[model samples]
Target: MSAFLRSRLLWPVVILIGLVALNVAFTDHFLRIQVKDGHLYGSLIDILRFGTPLILVSLGMTLVIATKGIDLSVGSIVAIAGALACVQISDLDDQNSVSGVLIAVGITLVLSLALGAWNGFLVAGVGIQPIIATLILMVSGRGLAQLIADGQIITINSSPYKLIGGGYWLTLPFSIFIVVALVALTAFLTRRLALGMFIEAVGGNAEASRLSGIRSRGVLIVVYTFCALCAGIAGLMISSNVSSADSNYAGLWIELDAILAVVIGGTSLAGGRFSISGTILGALIIQTLTTTIYSIGVPPETTLLFKALVVTIVCLLQSPAFRKRVARKRPRPPVTQTPVPVSDREPVTNR
Candidate 1:
């Protein structure tokens, strides 16, 4: 029980649950869901639906960060992915055609895979710092997306494309299915197949891992590529949900959010062991925080500050160093010893 309480995951879970309960108590509709026209609609559904993108991106990030690398380019990749896909669809003879949608998605994902490999190459092969390397793309990717989109937002009403984000199936959001599948696939690959161990080994000590026969470069490439792929999917959902792609606004600052989720989910920034389950929870908590902020009627300008305050509190609570300092600051209970009465005192014996 003590070990379980001490686990990194415990605090995030507790914070999430506490926030949820508070929301549930304060908002009548927070947990309410209704089915209309065979489609589920409600706050719970929206949370699951809107939170899917974060879940996917953070899952990928868990791997990248676990390998002591960060991809700041994910948000730009998100914009690029959706922009390219929409551009292709708009130019098609039938924008709503499934074939056109499939082609657009496939092309966008292929490009995303290539971009991810580029990041990996710079970091692993060229030895550039991950932040600087990804930042190059992060800045350029938006411009590239704007160029592809002709410096305008691309809007389309393709039903097939809409299904990726706004559609419903099985009386719930279809996006939930995507989230579940990706989560399961990631867990299987990392946990069951032991990919996580290799990542941890690399992150914990890259030279040691290479000496132990682990191919660090290959792992870096795969993880970065995977991160890009996840960002691409998120891009698709974001653009599809709104039926438009805005190079300037689409996925702006999402990479920060994903990194925050990964950190809040119990993954260390220094890199080593990671927890996908914790990342998922972290993503959900972030979405919930957004909802709570809106529900609390905070001003739009103040929302970011409010959210940051909450996040800071949570992060400090989760930080081992912060916790140690707090523990040290707390005064210990004074050790109280009662003096025995003279009659009740035991006789002193000298050997």
Candidate 2:
């Protein structure tokens, strides 16, 4: 029990459960679930539904951050992906055809992979800093999305495409299955395949990893590509759910949220060790916080401020150094010993 309590996994789960309980206290029905047309429906289900995109983005960001890198371009990638897919679907006469959705998805994913590779090249091949490399796309990706979308919100009525985001399978949100599959696959690839160690080594010390025979460049390229891929899938989900692609607003500031989730999950930004389970918990926390804001009637202007405040407090709470300092005992002032003992002992020194 002690060991379990001390585990890094403990706190985040506790915090998430606490937040859920808090919501329950306020709403009184936060956990209640109902079945409608064989689909589970409730606040909990809604959280899972709405939180899926953020979860995917944050999960990808986890790998990048684990390599001591950050991808600021994920939001833009999201927009581009959704825009590209929607454009393809909108151009098709048989909007509801599964083939149209499949082609669009395939094309979008390939494009996303290429974009991710571009980031990898700039960083690994060109030796540019990861932040700088990703920033290039971060700034330009939105424009590319707009150019593809022609500065218009392209709406489609593709039922098959919408299923990716809004459909239910086995009475649960289909996105839940996607998130679970991705998470499981990531765990397998990282832990089972030993890629996690390579990533950790690279992040812990790139030169050391290179000298030790790990292909650092390959790792970087793979991670960055995977990150963009995750963002692309998220873009699809976003566009599909709404049946529209608004490039301008599709994934605005999602990178920040993803980073926030990664940080909250207790993953070190400096890179090294990471926790996928922790990241999932962090994403849930973020979604919960967002939900709590509106349920509690926070003003629109102050909502972001409130989120920042909460995040700061949680980060401080999670910081070992900060906690240690706060919990440390103050140094007792050096005790002043009277010199009288010397005089008192002088009589015994004759021997």
Best by TM-score: 2
Q: For candidate 2, give the lDDT of residue 206.
A: 96
Residues 203-268, model 2: lDDT tens digits: 999999999999999999999999999999999999999999998999999999999899988899
**Model 1: residue 324 alpha-carbon error in angstroms:** 3.7
Model 1 residue runs over 4 Å out of place are 1-3, 328-351
Question: How well does candidate 2 match the true structure in TM-score terms?
Answer: 0.94
Best by lDDT: 2
Instruction: Determine the C-alpha RMSD for candidate 2 after optimal superposition of all C-alphas.
Output: 2.4
Each candidate's TM vs. the true structure?
A: 0.93, 0.94
Give the Cα lDDT of each candidate. Answer: 0.92, 0.93
Tell me the TM-score of model 1.
Answer: 0.93
lDDT of 1 by residue, 270-315 (tens): 9999999889989999999998888768899999999899899999
